[model samples]
Each structure stands twice: as structure tokens, then as C-alpha cells.
Target: MIILYDISCTRHNTAWSPSTWKTRYVLNYKGLSYRTEWVEFADIEALSIKHGFAPSGKRADGSPRYTLPAIYDESTGAKIADSSLIADYLEATYLDTPSLYPHNTRALQAAYEAAVLAHLDAIHQFTAPYLMTKKYFTPKTEEYYRKFREPAFGGKRLEDLLPFGAERVKQWERLKNDIGKIAAWYDKNDRKGSFLLGETPSWADFVAASFLVWLRVIWGEESEEWKDLETWHNGRWKKLFAAVKKYEAMA
Candidate 1:
């Protein structure tokens, strides 16, 4: 069995981090047996250190930065951090299961993931404020998140990052337009499929879907923003989300 580490959220105990969602999608799609271990934002670094999990990245000061979406593979006694690395480990270890990178498309899939994330800047900016709300995070985690992220936004209060009214509307429009650009990429697909590579589901789809899932989780399905998103680009996002919805199981 595998122990997948995920960032905890206050809403329904669901896994909400987009990075972690990528791993969850891979695990579920491959039919792997795993259980989620929810960790508070404040504890991620300590947890990583305790388990000897590799740092996910580096901080601005070049200090090692630890994050969740890590995994402990009980079967192999392997502890891995970072979503992409976890996917690679799983792909290499589970030969019998379906591959996330099929037909030697690992490089292409990695590029696609980077491309998709590059276009998500507006979405990230627009959603940051909502993510800081007390409704989304526990007390301690929220405090940690705010302290850790406020500096990035020039020390502005989370709500001030994108205030409501005209500014918020402008940011939302930017997000929608950015999403349209990504949708145009799907339009170039020569065949009809919910995935990036024609009829085959791969890591590329998981990467794209994770952002959509992030949007849905942060905005709430019933929010006007999410509803608007569902109708955009001829409902392509909605369909893509539906196709991968089954793989959203947390465990």
C-alpha cells in the first residue's frame, strides 16, 4: 500500500491542492491501492524532515523547501516528494498497471504540463484571495499560509491581493481569457477526445484537470465563477472535468 501525503482543507476533508491532485489522479487511474495522510500546512516541513523526504524545491534564499504531495511507498520502502517525481516512481514501479506516459511520451507530456501551468498565472492570482479565507483552511494552517504567502504579494492582506468589484472583475476576465487560450490548444487536437493525446488518457490530462479541480475546489462548484467556467470554450472544460471526475477519489 502507498501513503499519499496531501494538504488538508477545512471543507469536507477533501484533498484540494492542485499539485497533490495530480498524484491522486495518477494513483486512481492506475488502480493503485493507497490511502491519503492529510497534513496541515504548518507541519509539511517538519513532516518532510522526519520522513527524510526530499525537498520539493528551494526557497528564495536558496533554502530547501519541503511540501506535500509526497508519498511513502510501503512496498518499496521509498519516500518521495514532489508530484512529478512521485508519478515517475509509480510509473517505474508498477509495470503491470496502465502507464501515465505512454509510448515514450514522457518528455512531451512534461512539456505539456509546463505549458499548461504557464497559462495559469491569472487563475492563480484570482484565486489566491479566496484560498486564504477561513472557510478554506484550518486556523493553524491558514495562519501559516498567510504568513508564508503574504510576502509574495508584497505583504498585502490576502483579500487585498485582488479586491472585489472592478478589480476582481478584471482579474476574473483575465483568468477566463487565459483559460480560453488553453482551450484553443485542445481545439488543435486532430481527433475527438477529452484527453490531450487523442483517445488516450495520460499525465498531460491529469495536469490540466488538476488545475480545473483546483479552480472548482477554491471557487466552489456553485459559485458564479465556476458556473461561468463550466460554460466557457464551448464547455470543453466541463467535459474534460467529467471525464476525469471518477479518478478524483481520495483513497
Candidate 2:
């Protein structure tokens, strides 16, 4: 069995973190037996270091990296960090499970993953204000989140970025423009199929779905943003969301 380190949200019913969703999706999609360990933001560095993984990456000031969405495989004594590496590791280690990466398409799959992740910063910018202010967080997690994120926001308070009233509408419009790029790409290449690559839900599907899944995690399924996304690119986002639904953890 493997242990997945997930970000904890003590006050929210939905236990999710955007970056971690990719790994969890792969684990569940492959029917791998694993249990999630809830980790707060403050503890990720120490926990990751203890698991024998390197720091996640360098800080803006060249500090050591420490982040979550890491996995410790008790079965093989392998500890992996980073979602892309984890997905590749799982596919290679579990040959009997369904393959997420197509044969000889590792490069393409990586490109697809990159394409989807390209929008991550914008999505986070659109959602972070609401996510930080209203969503679940223990006091420690909240404190750590602010400290870690403030630098990225040009030293502006997270709450200060929240748009309201007319500004909120404008924010949504801008977000839609960013999402439109993705939707347009899908529309051009989908070839009228549900999945990005025709019938199968490949890594491309998982990568694309992870974005909206993160949104759904932060905002409830019934949120206006979720509903609005459903209508994008002729319901393509909605279709992708539905395609991955079966892979989600069963209640």
C-alpha cells in the first residue's frame, strides 16, 4: 500500500488541494490501494524531508523546497515527490494496471500536462481570494498559506485581491477568457469525442480534469463558477468532468 500526503482542510467537507488532485486521480484511476494522510501546509517540508524526498524546489530566495502531493510507497520503499514523476512512477511500477501514458507518447503526454498546467496560475489567481477567505483551513494552515503565498502576490494581502460587485463580474469575464484558450484547443482537437484523445481517458484527460476538479473542490459542485464552466466550448469541460467522475473515490 502507498500513503498519499494530501493537504488538510479542517473546516471544509471537501478534502482537496489542486496540485495533489493529479496524484490522487492517478491512484484511484489505476485502482491502486492507498490511504491519504492529511498534512497541513506548515508540516509538508518536514514530512517530505523525513520521507527521504528532496525539497520540492527552491524558494524565491533560493530556500530549500518543501511541498505536498508526495507519496511514500511502503510496499517498495520508494518515496516520490512531484505529481508528474508520481504518475510516471505508478505507470512503470504497476504494469498490470491500466496505463495512463500511451505507448511511445510520453512526450505528448508531458506536453498535454504542461498545456493544462499553463492555466494553473490564472485559475489560482481567480480562485485564491475566495479560497483563502472562505474555504477550510486550520489556523496553522491558514497562517502558513498566507506566509507562503504573500510573496507570490507581490506582497498584497490575499483578501485584498478579492473582487466584489462589478469587479467580481469583471474577474469572472477575464477568467473565462483564459479558460477559453483551453476550450478552444479542445474543440479544435477533440474530433467530436468526449475524451481529449477520442474514447479513452488517458493522462491528458486526467490532467485537464484536474483543473476543474480543483475548482469544484474549492467551490462546491453547485457553484456558479462550476456551472459556468459547464457551458464552455459546447460543454466540453462538463463532459471532461463527467468522464473522470468514475475514477473519483467512491463514497
Candidate 3:
């Protein structure tokens, strides 16, 4: 059996967070059995140490990798580091079931799926700074949920993360606006149905939508607080959410 450590609550979204969702989705899609490992700041150190995921390169220099969505396959004693890599690895190893990335590379469909993967990756990186705020970050005073400077009022506190600070808040608002653009793109592109690929769920259907789930969390789901997002989510992304909910219940 393979081991999948879906690192949630890491305070950051970089570590294949949504990839974890998609990896799990593909696991179900392929009918492969695996276990999930969840984490927050208190336990992250222990989890990384136990699993040899201790930040080595830049992490040793006081900067952290801050990436999750780790995949450990004890069966072959191999650990996969990145999220998208995990997706490709799984599809290649398990050739028996419905192909996640179509086997036919000659066709434009396969090319298009690869393009979607790259596009989602680019989108996440391009928008990461805006997507999350200090809310997701743990406190600096303690191991988790720490606070830094006052929101934008104090300009002297550079070391501390200003939760409500001007820069962070501005970036957050910008993210909201940026997402509106993304939503426009979604409306223009995905007006067909829940799945990006129409009818059947594809890798894009599962993975791209996973980030969307996070975006909604930050924005709110069908709540008046973010009525625009809520309406869009309730109307369009409902099917993706439904798929995740249904798959989770299988256990």
C-alpha cells in the first residue's frame, strides 16, 4: 500500500495543498488505497522529522520550504516531494485503471490536459501572495497562530507579520479583485458545466477546482460577507464540491 500525507493547516498553501486534494481524487479515481496525514503547526515539526521531510536546503537558513502535499510510498520506499509530480507519478505507476492523464499523447486532448496542468501551476504561483493572509499563518510568539505588528498602523515592524497590516491587507484585497478576474475567466471558459472537461471529471476538473475551494474559503462560501463569490461558487463550483464530499464519504 502507498502512503499519502495530505498536509493541511500548514498556514501556507504552497505545498501541493490543492494537489493533495487532486492526488486524493485520483487515488479514488484509480481505486487505489492510501491513508491521509493531516497537520497543523504544533505537530508539523514532529511529522517532518519522523518522515525525514525536515527542511534541508533553504529551510536550514531560517527560511522554510513552506510546501506541503507530500506523498510517501512505503511500498517502494520512495517519497514524492511536489504535488504535480505526485499526479504524474501515480498515473504512470497505475496503468490498469481509467487514465488520469490520457495515455494518448498524440492527441490534442492530452496536450490540452498538460497545458491545463501548467496553467494551473502558473496561476497558483502568480497569485499565491494574494491568495492567503496572516490568518492562515501561525503566531510568531508561540509555535502556531502568532501575531506580528498591528494592521498597517505600524511601519517599523518588518520582522513581524502584520495580520491586519496595510501591505498584507492590501495584497489580500488585491487577491479578491484578482479572483474576480479569474472568476470572469471561469465564466467565460467553464460556462459549460461543473467539470472543466465537460461530462466526465478530468484532472483539471479535480485539481484546478481544489484551489477554487480554497479561494472560496478565504472569500466565504455562499455567505453574504462575500455575496459575489458565494453566488458564483454556489452556482458553478457546486459539482466539484459535491465530488469531493462524495469521495470523502466513501471511507
Candidate 4:
């Protein structure tokens, strides 16, 4: 069986990391046999290094940066890191399963993933404050998260990053407009379908849905922000979320 390395959070009822969700969606969509090994934020580096998983990237100071959503495929003795690389490994190894990069659209799918991240950049600010709450993280993980994130915010407290009131409303409106821009991309799909490739699921769909899942998990499904999102862009996102629901299993 394959072992997927994911981040551990207080919310054990569901997986919440958007990056790991991409791999989880792929694993569940392909119907693969796997189990999750949840690691806390502070332990990711040590555990990854001990297990010989390669660094996913580098920090600003050029030190190796380790992250979760890595995998140890016992059958093949392959230790893979990074969600995209893990998807590629699974696609290549599991020939009998569904293809993530169908129609030889790997390059297009990569581009679409990049575009999604670029357009949703503001989401970090919108969701960062929630990470400090006990509802989402423990004191240890919250401290780790704070140290990892505060430098980027110029040492501001997470609560002050986007305080409630006019500034928050303006940011919310901006996020809505940005999501509308992504909706415009879906409109060009040639045929009406819940996925980017009209009626067929692909990695692009997972890339998009992972972010939606992140928003839903962080904001809570019944939160006013999520309710607003549900009706945006002619309910495009809500429909997409439904389309991907079948592949949301943690196993």
C-alpha cells in the first residue's frame, strides 16, 4: 500500500491543506489503495529528512524547504515529494487507473494550475487569520504556522493582517471579482460542463477544486463568505464543487 504524507491539524474530520488536497483528489479519483500519515507543521522537515524524501523547494535564504503531500510507494520503493510530481508518479505507475493528464494536455494543465494560484493569491490573507484559532490548529502547530507566515506579513499579527471592517469588505469584494475572472475561463470550455474540459474530469479540475475546498474548510460551509461564494459567477464554483465531491474520500 502507498503511504501519503499529509499535514496534521486539529480538524481530523477532514483534510484541509489545499496542496495536499490536490494529491488526495488524484489518489481517490484513481481509486488507488493508500493510507495517510499526518505530520505536524514543525515536524515536516525532520520527518521528511529522516525518510529520505527530497525537499520540495527552497526557502528565500536558499535552504532546502520540505513540505507535505509527499508519498512513499512501498510497491515501487519511490519516495516522491510535491503534489504535481506525486500526480505524475501515480499516473505513470498506475496504468490501469484514470489518467489525470488526459488528451496529452500536461502543459496546458500545468499552465492552468499556475493561473489558478496567481488569481487566488489574496486567499492567503483572507484565510490566514483562521489558522490561529483552536478550531483549526493546536497551540504548537499555530505557533509554527505563525513563525512560518509572519515574516511575509512584515511581522504583523495574523489577526491584524486583514482586520474586520472596511478593509475586510474591500478585500472580500476583490476576492469575489478575482473568482469571477476564473469563472470567465470556465465559460470558454466550448460546451457546458462542470469541469474545465467539458464533461471530462482532469488535473485542471482538481487544481481548481482544491482551492474551493480550502475556502470551504477555512471559512466554514455556513459562513457568510462561503454563502457569498456559493452564488458567485452564476453558481459556477458551487457546481464545480459538487462535480468533484465523489473524489473527496480521505482513503
TM-score of 1: 0.96
Model 1, span 104-148: residue lDDT tens: 999988888788888887775767778776367778987988888
Q: In candidate 4, list every pair of residues with a backbone clash.
A: none
Cα-lDDT of candidate 2: 0.78
Per-residue lDDT tens digits for candidate 4, residues 1-251, read 99999888887756788999999999999999999998888889999999999999887778999998899999999999999999999999999999998899999999988888889767777787787753577788778877877877889888777656888888888888887878999988788789999888999999888888888988899998899899999899999999999999887
In candidate 3, which residue ranges exceed 4 Å CA deviation? Answer: 8-16, 42-66, 103-193, 216-222, 225-227, 248-251
Q: Write the per-residue lDDT of candidate 2 for residues 1-251, one digit (tens) a residue.
A: 99988877765335566678888888998999998888877888888877787676899989997777888899998888888888989999999998887666779888877776676555666667766777577788788888988889888788787777998788777778777877777777736677767776677777777777878877778888788878877787888877788777822
What is the C-alpha lDDT profile of model 3 across 21-50, one tens digit per residue?
Answer: 667777777777787666653455467667
How would you order the candidates by lDDT, starting with the best?
A: 4, 1, 2, 3
Better of 3 and 4 by TM-score: 4
TM-score, candidate 2, is 0.92
Q: How many backbone clashes does candidate 2 have?
A: 1
Kindly report which residue stretches of model 2 are placed more than 4 angstroms away from their true locations once superposed. Answer: 190-192
Better model by TM-score: candidate 1 vs candidate 3: 1
Ranking by TM-score: 4, 1, 2, 3
